[model samples]
Target: MANTKEIQNRIKSIKDTQKITNAMYMISSSKLKKARTDLENTEPYFYTLQVALARMLRHVPEMEHLYFDSREGIKEEDRRRGYLVITADKGMAGAYNHNVIKIAEQELAAHPNSELYVVGQVGRHYFAKKGVPIDIHFQYTAQNPSLHRARVIADKMLENYENGDIDEVYIIYTNMKSSVVVEPQMIQLLPMKRTDFAGVPADVFHEEITMEPSPKAVLDRIVPNCVMGYIYGALVESFCSEQNSRMMAMDSATKSAKEMLDDLNIKYNRARQAAITQEITEIAGGARAQRDRS
Candidate 1:
């Protein structure tokens, strides 16, 4: 029922929106590709280090590294946990930001009185709206996930873990598999898992090695560095996931807007044609009636 002018304006508005979304999609595409390459290159090193540590631990049962230290038997009263929630700094990424914050909410609800460390502005704002207080709000590193920035964040996490402020640390972020697929994940960063190592199945190698500086001393040097490497890898994965999610979201939005504009333009053209035909019929009938009167 809209007039021609009104329909024209609506089409123009949608076209402008489509342009913006298209630009965003292109930008995200470039960033996602770079991030994935970075993640691929760095992840192997972390895996190798973890495998070496696992093999060493198997041979040297006397090793007592804090990272591999077990707190599995601790009482409930002594258990306090920390959460590091990673989200995108900007919006227009569909449910990417929302899903991550929802995951954090579920986690916090399950474990009461947990400390929160937020990486992105989106997560920080989400927690603030839910009346959740953040213990640490890191901005620059979250915006740009590079090796140096990741190292700084990891060192800070290590400091907190060593000081006994938190018993366990968890990182919540999205994992990128490909351009269109991103999976949300919650992984334990501190108190590293015993099973996720490259050298776990190599039993022959574990038995033959002898420690020169002692296994415990080697673990003290290696475990923390390896943990840092893992954190860096996670950061790279998270960065890729964010960009991929945004790119897909924008692509969908642009396509939807184009379809809507096409539909509206069709309707407008039909209405205008109908109006023109009615006017032509009226003019012809008026001329015939005038000739008959003459």
Candidate 2:
């Protein structure tokens, strides 16, 4: 009976846990949908900006801009690199945060003279707990990514890049192509290189566009938008990936809970049957002993 009671209690506890997990699964699913919608909505705008920038560059091959040049106005002795890592504000998101952080650490290791900027509470807390230095941390961006927040981060980073406080800028984030497809990507954001414009075809420069003012002026304005777009796009993708990860994690948890509940039910039934068998045996033995005494 004691064993039966313990099994019953465990079964009850697991049922309660399953309920919570199911609820969480549903919640994460809803959030994932919204995040994906936001991601999709922002996708075209950024890609268009990137395309336009590429086209502008192709139009004037000799165009010179501060964006393309890595003129970090500081002396070589004071030169440092900047690395920005995007993660999730909350956990229970599978390997979303883990993957990003792991790669970011690699970036930090690769660039010994690097300053770290992190987006997400998880990254901030993890780094702080590990005593890893972080120069900047945006605590709220992961939960709710916005163009405004992206701009704020971009402005600061661009300023640092321009002033030569940091020469190279790398952004590490999870790129969510779909719910099932999320990959950790580390991309250099500063000193726009020709390779960065891989999206534009090689022969795109064959066409000619009339430059109203000048190609240099046009590129100068468009290049900054390119940077801002990259930052915003990463934030959007990371946000979507985080939500999808949470949803998947919760779904897995719910399924595991169901399996556990099934196993617990089996154990509970076995214990219950054993108790009943023992009770029936004692009753039959007592009856036989009475018959013998009679």
Candidate 3:
């Protein structure tokens, strides 16, 4: 059993920690709200891009480009796969980071020879410990997610894919739905395929607009932009999900701390009362014995 002073100090320390956790919870909640709104806005743009790209594919049926064609018959010497694993820069978000790492490990289980790209500190650490071969580690100083940062990451993946360092690029991130719901998602980012652009809008589906250079030239430019847009969307989703997870985890911690404080306070009061009663009883006995002797 700890002495009164020791117990009191411990309680004080826990109270201070509880205060910090509560503040963090509030901060996470506020950020989650803003992130949620941003993610919602991006959804429409993603759909629009998908529709536009689908339209382009429909209008150009005879497009004999790698972006629209299959390379199944190509030799194994011609292809390499790249996996981009995105996670939170910090932890304290329950299993949020763990789930992403686990899914990525599972997905890459069969591809030991594939190149790995990591986007966050958590994922980088996990894969590094697992002996995963990382070809690139993207670093960002932003405390929050930025579209520009995401575009840079997109460019890195695109450049590698186009330069033949990677045959296919895949993005792994946590998809945000709500504060309580975050799902891990794995999406292919490269080898720009026509089938990947299946959701284009009907109106823009077949507009035969002339390009300034040529169809191949237009696609070459648009493909990178498309990759950038997709990566930006994924980063937004992953950040939002991280905020939500942190908020939820901190909420639970705050609640648990409150309960523990309540229990400890009750125990301290009971111990103090017991000690006082014992002192009073001893004094009463001493007084009675003295009176009898008198």
Best by lDDT: 2
Ranking by TM-score: 3, 1, 2
Candidate 2 TM-score over all chains jointly: 0.90
Q: Candidate 2 residues 1-294, lDDT tens each?
A: 349778788878888887887887788777778767876788877777777777776666677677788665666555587989998878988999999999978867766688999998899999899888999887688778888898899999989987878887889999987768899998989888865776675434547788668777777677677788888889878887887887788778878878888887888888888989999999999999999999
What lDDT score belongs to each candidate, Candidate 1 first?
Answer: 0.80, 0.82, 0.78
lDDT assessment of candidate 3: 0.78
Per-residue CA lDDT of candidate 3, range 1-294, in tens? 555666688789889989988999889878877876876777776666666666666777677776554467756655677888889889998898999888778867766558888888888888888787778888862246666787788888878776767778888888886657999989887777776566444553334666668778877777777787788778878887888888888888989888888978877887788888999999999999999999
The C-alpha stretches of model 1 lying farther than 4 A from their native spots are: 198-214, 285-294
Stretches of candidate 2 off by over 4 Å are 71-79, 198-216
Estimated TM-score for each candidate:
0.90, 0.90, 0.91
Per-residue lDDT over 1-294 for candidate 1, one digit per residue giving the tens place of the 0 to 100 score: 787788899999999999999999999888877877777777777767777787876666565667765577867657778888888888878788888888889988888868998988888888898889899877766557887877777788888888878778888888877667888889888877565553356534644887668776877677777867866777777778888888888989999998999899998998788889989999999999999999
Report per-prediction Cα RMSD to one decimal: 2.4, 2.8, 2.3
Between candidates 1 and 3, the lDDT winner:
1
Candidate 1 local Cα displacement, residue 183, angstroms: 1.8
